[model samples]
Every structure is written in C-alpha cells, then in structure tokens.
Target: MYYNTNILKSTDGESICYYRWQANPDVPFKGIVQIAHGLGEHAGRYNHIAHLLQEEGYSVYANDHRAHGKTAEIKRLFGYYDGKEYFDDCIADMYALTNLMRAENPNSKFILFGHSMGSLLSRKYVIKYGKELDALILSGTASFIKVLGTIGLVTASTVKTFKGRERGNAFLKDFFFGEFNKKFKPNRTKLDWISTDEAQVDLFEKDPYRTEDFSLGVFLDIIKNSKKVNSPEAFKATPKELPILMFSGDKDPVGEMGKGVTRVAKQYEKYGISDFTFKLYKGGRHEMLNEINAEAVEQEIISWLNQRI
Candidate 1:
C-alpha cells in the first residue's frame, strides 16, 4: 500500500511532502527506511525503490526537503543563501516524520537512506541524532565543499552578493556538469542517469517537481554545510558505533575533487569510526541508483540492510 500526506513542521513553518509504502500493514514490519533524495529531485522519484523495500518487509517513508518538490518556499527552496538552515530544516522534518512513523507503527526499528546532497544531510543528522536509527546508507556521497572549501566559499559569496535573485546558469555548467560536458558532446537535456531512454529524460525535463537551477544563496549554503561535514570536529562528533554504508560511482564528477563517497568513508575510518563500509562502482556515474544496473545497486542496499537490521 502507498500513501501520501503533508507533514507540517512547526520549526520552519514548512509543510513537508511525505510518502509511505508498506506491503503488509498487519504483518510486523522489520523496520522503516526514510529516504532523502538528492538535489534537484523529489522524494516521489524513489517510488520504485520504496516498492522493492516494501516487498522485503520494510515500510518506506520519504519526504521532499524544504526547497525541492512541493515544499518550495517563496524566497528560496530551503534557505535563501544560508544552507545550514536547509540542513537544520531537513533534520527537523525528518525528526518530526520519524516520530510520526513511530506513532503510526510502534515497536519497529528505523533506518535512513540518503542520496547525494541528501546523504550529506543524513550524515549530519546522524552525528546529532545517532540514537534515532539502526543504520544508514549513503549513495552518491561526497565531501565536495570540504575539498574545495575556499574556492566554493568565494564563488558562492560572489555569486549571491552580486547576482541577488537573478538566476544564473553558468555555475551549474562550470561546477556540476562541466566534466560530463567535456567527456560527451554536451546535450542540454541528456541529464538523466546517462540513459538512452528518451522518455525518461523527457519526463524529467517536464517534471514540475524538479529544480533545474538553484539560487546563489542555496549554492553557497551547500558548500558551507559540506565543509562542516569534512572537518575533524564533525567526524569526532559522529557516533563511531553507528553502522554506515557509503557508495558512489568511480566515474562520478563529484569524486573529481578526491572527496567522493569512498573518501568520506576513509575520513570516518581515520577517526577510528568502525562499522562503516564504502564501495565504488567501476563504471558508475553520480546517479548510481538510477543507472543502467540499478537492480544491482538496489540489491546491494538490500543485502547491507539485511546484515545490519
């Protein structure tokens, strides 16, 4: 069964869009997985993944962060230019939803599954609220801002201070999509998981839930919050015993700065954080979960969840 609802988060005055799926409500659930999607995408995109998990006896819940999808604010998506507000809002929204789920389905364990920027938020949340979950899975993860901290800070500040509300497209090209453009002949709309499915790309292009461009303020906020995750202080604050699984594609541009998903795992390991595992798909790209071999990626996630929970 699948259900959709709006969760009102009082802290930020944001009504987060939440989706729930369960195969058997009567049968005791193994646990619940709260999925946090990456930037520019909405929680609904993971319905297929949620269906698979529901079939495996785990209920699934997902929410669109403040700025993305149905939760967009007038000024900006999450926060105008300060990214920490977005992270804080995301954590609060997750906390509220988790408590709501616990109330709805008592006595069940809980896990967190976050992708891309969502993974970053998940990590920060775990550090602050590690006791809330049984395990965590981070996909297409990175510490980009950590690696390019100074540069990102300068760029974001310059963009926001000068450009204000005027939308800018150069940043996306220069930062996120540059490598892909270099490797392949740049196609403006060929942005969906490197697939030949024209229909998929077309749907994504027309999806009202998707955000093609971000504000300069939000861009800077991503960098600032990312830097927090990269610091030694952040690692030390993280609960060492919490089981974590992180993975990314070796060919992912996010890994270009040497701070990809594997790098994130190594950082935790360096801080004596055990019970963490990292994997890299040889030919995979940023959106591994949506890639050609998505089944393999999904299977890996299921297998890991089986061991941990």
Candidate 2:
C-alpha cells in the first residue's frame, strides 16, 4: 500500500500536513485508522505501521500535530504552540482530520491510535468526541501524577515568565526526560529508554525532526492536559461503550514502570468502560512499536483489531 502526502486546513486555519494510506483497492475496505504520534516525532515515523494497516484492508491517516513534524516546518513554529490554547487546538485539528476521514468512509469503523503524548490528547478527545470513534488504541500511555504535574506546570510557567515562551528550556527538558534513561544503566544514548533496539534509538537521534528541543510553553501545555486526562471527571465523561485498548512496556518510565498504566486501566474499569483491554510487555521499554519485539507487538495489535472489526 502506498501513501499520499496532503495538507488539510485545521479548525484555526493552521495547515496540517497529513499522510493518507488507502487500503488495497482490490480488497474490501476494513476500517479507518487515524494515528497520533508521540512528542518530538513526525507522522512519517509510523509509515511502516500505516502500511501494515493498509495491507490489512484498513485505510490509515496521520497528521503532523501543531509545532511538530511537517506542520511545524511549514509554519516555522517548531516547538512553539503560539497561544494559550495549545492542547485544545491540537484536539480541534485532530477532529478536523477525523471529519475528513469520516466523510470519505462514512460506513467504515474509525479507530484512533495514539502514542505517548498523543495518547494523552486522544484520552482528552474521547471525553468530548468519544461517539465519533468506533475504538481507541493508546500506546505508551500512563495515568498522570497530579503532584508532579502541578510542580512541573508551575516550574514551566515560572521559566516562561523569566525567559520567553519560544525559548527552549534545557533544564525543563531534562526535568521531564532525564530520569527516563536512568533505568538503563550505562546507557548507549540519552534515548535508550525509548526502545531496547539500539538502531531505532540511533535513527531517532539522527532524525532532525526528532532532535528539536521543546519549549517551556509546550511542556506547560502537556502537563496541564496530562492532568486533565487523568481526572475522575474526565473518566466519567468518556463514552462507556467505546472499546479501548491500552498497551505499554513494563519498563516505560513515562508509564512509571507500568504502575501508572495499571492505574489507568483501573480507572477505565471504575468509570464503567467494560470493553477495555490492557497489555503489558515484560522487559519492554517505552516505544514498543520500535522495540526488538516490535513485530510481535504489531501482530498483537492487528489481532486485537481483527477481533473488534
């Protein structure tokens, strides 16, 4: 399956560069998979996953979120949200893309796949627009720690007050990701915590788009939204009927070594989302999709989707 790169106008008139992988023309269309990538990465990183889904008769679409990937390149606003409504704006842009996909395949099931920070955005999305999706897949997701989130938000805000929102705060960046690589003692690189696969980490380090330092404002936005998604009210607002699959590595620091991921699962159960599934890969790190056992992880995802659709 091949993909086409196109631009879509977001709700606020931001130009969102997206990729669309149409399912095999000869095969019956199965469904639609909209991918939301993690922070500091582009939608293009998931092209292989899109190909797999397209081959399985599912059309795939992924957009470069604001201040990331091609969209950031086009706007020249790398790592800058440019406004206070950063998180909401990203969700709106996602909804815009969702509407486009639904318009093209009105009868097909729609699945939203989000990884890491994207997973947080997707969680927020379900609260407002859960009915718009047939299912949800969250990768490298976690339940937010309220106390730490509050401190991070305050710290980021203070930094932005002293410096500028557009200036990248190396201290804030370290504060967020510094501890992630600690588990992997004598780490080969700073991003070894992302995946056990050294090659993937190398590729990430080499990719210019992935190397962009996030601004303090971006950190603040992420912390604020992370808290929102983890709130009990947000859980109650989620559509209980929507099927959700949450998967992560046991060693993923973002998931707090799997404890946070488990907490999220329990929250879903408490909120009456009976059709929720949680999977933890032993010894796996943050980015299971790029890990050594990535093929197995991909197969597991496909198997789950097949059962659902």
Candidate 3:
C-alpha cells in the first residue's frame, strides 16, 4: 500500500513531504531503503520503483528535497541563498525520517539509495553518519560539478553586483545542452534522460513539481559543497570499512569528463578504501531508474543489497 504524508522537521523548520510504501508490514522487514532523487525531479517520480521494492519485501520511503517538488521555498524552480543549507536540511530531514521509520520497525536494517546530485549528498551524509546505515548505493555519480559551479559563480557575482537585475535561462541552456547544439535544436522539452522518449520528455516538461532553473546563489552553494565532498578531508572522514556501491552509465555526460563514476571509486581506492563496488552500464543514461530497461537496473541493485545487507 502507498501512503503520503508530511513531517515537520523541527531541526530545520521545513516540512518534508514523503511517500511510504509498506511491504509486508506484519512480517518483520529485512530492511528499509530511503531514496534521494537527482536535480529537476521529485520523489514522486519513483512511485514505480517504490512499488517494485515493496514487492521485494522491503519498506521504501522517499522525500522531496527542499526547494524541489512540494517543499516550501523561494524562486519556484530555482533555489536561492546558501546551497550548504540545502544539503544540511536534506541530511537532517533524512535523519528525522530514518528515526521515525526505525521506531516503527525496530528490527529492520537501513540503507540509502541516491541518484545523481542526490548521490553527492548521500556521500556527505555517509561521511557524517556512516555507522548508522548498513549500505549505500550511488547512481549516476561523478566527482566534480562539471562547470556548473564556474557559471554559477559568475552569475552570482553578476546578480550581487547588479541588484534588481534578472538573468535569463541562457546559462542553463548553454551548460546542459551546449554540446548537442549542432546535432539537435535546444528545446527545454527534450531535457529528459538524454534519450529519445518523446512521451517521457513531454511528461517531464509538464510536471508541475519539476524545477528547471536554480538561482545563481543556490548553484554556487552546490558547487562549494561539491568541492568539499570531493576533498581529501571529506574522503578520509568516510570509514574505510563502509560498503559502498557506485554505478553510472558510460554514455552519461557525468562519465564524459575525466571525473566519471569510476574516477570517484579510484580516488577512494587511493585512500585505501577497498570496501566498495563500482559498475558501468553499457549504454545507460543519467536517469537509469527511469530508463527503458529499469528492471535490469533494479535487479542489479536488489542483488547487491541482498549480498551486502
């Protein structure tokens, strides 16, 4: 069964909206999995995945991050102000929800599954609270911000210098679609999964909960946090024995740069962190969970969790 509710996080004064899929509530659960979605998307998009997990005898919970989906915030589609605040709020909110879930199911193990930007935040949370989780899965992850930070810094400075000036969405278009400019026209509608699914693309464009733009300040904040997470200090903070699963698509742009998912694993290996597994999907894209053969991906995830947890 599916249930939706909101929990007021006293820690940050933000009401976190979430969904819970109860699978075999009577029988003791093997574990609980919390999902964190990528940018421009909301937790509701994972309804199908939640159902699948439920069928697999696992309770699933997902929350829409602040400034995204039904969460309260300014600048509708774009997040303004401190990006670290966003990350902090997300961690606090996740912790709060985990506590609540644990209270209800005391015997179940806890695991976290994060995608894209969410994967970045998951790593930060793990470094701080690694002992609390049994396992972690990072999908479509990379070690760097991919120039979004540089563009955000410039735009943030411009906004600060010229108060009351509004910048166009040209930066977003350029940063996300600049490479495909010659091959295909830059239409905001085609920004789903970097694939050819017109129907899915249309759904994404029409989704009211989806955010397409972010404030210069918020973008810069994310850049700063991203850098911190990739730093040697943060890498060292993570326990060497914590089991981590990292996966990404070979064709995804995150894998295009020298800072691909494998690069992330290699960095950790350099620090003697060997309790991890990294996989690359041959032709998958950024949103592997939403791809054509999502079952294959889901099965892979379940198999990993079964072995580790």
Candidate 2 — which pairs collide?
A: none
Error of 1 at 75 (Å): 10
Where is model 2 poorest over a 10-residue stretch in terms of lDDT?
210-219
Tens digits of per-residue lDDT for model 1, 4-66 = 656556456656778788745555468989998888788988888888888788988888776
Q: How close is candidate 3 to the true structure, as a TM-score?
A: 0.85
Model 2 lDDT per residue over 1-309, tens place: 378888999877879999999998777789999999888899999988889888899999999988898888896778776666678988999999999998988888999999999999999998899987889999999788666677788888898888877778887777777767887889889898999889999999898787447767788888888888999999999999998999999999999899999999899999899689999999999999999999999999999998998
TM-score order of candidates, best first?
2, 1, 3
Q: Which candidate number would show the highest lDDT if scored against the true structure?
A: 2
lDDT of 3 at 145: 51
Better of 2 and 3 by TM-score: 2
Cα lDDT tens digits, model 3, 173-228, are 35644542223345444563444446666777788787756544445445667778
Candidate 1 lDDT trough over 10 residues, lowest sum: 74-83
Better of 1 and 2 by TM-score: 2
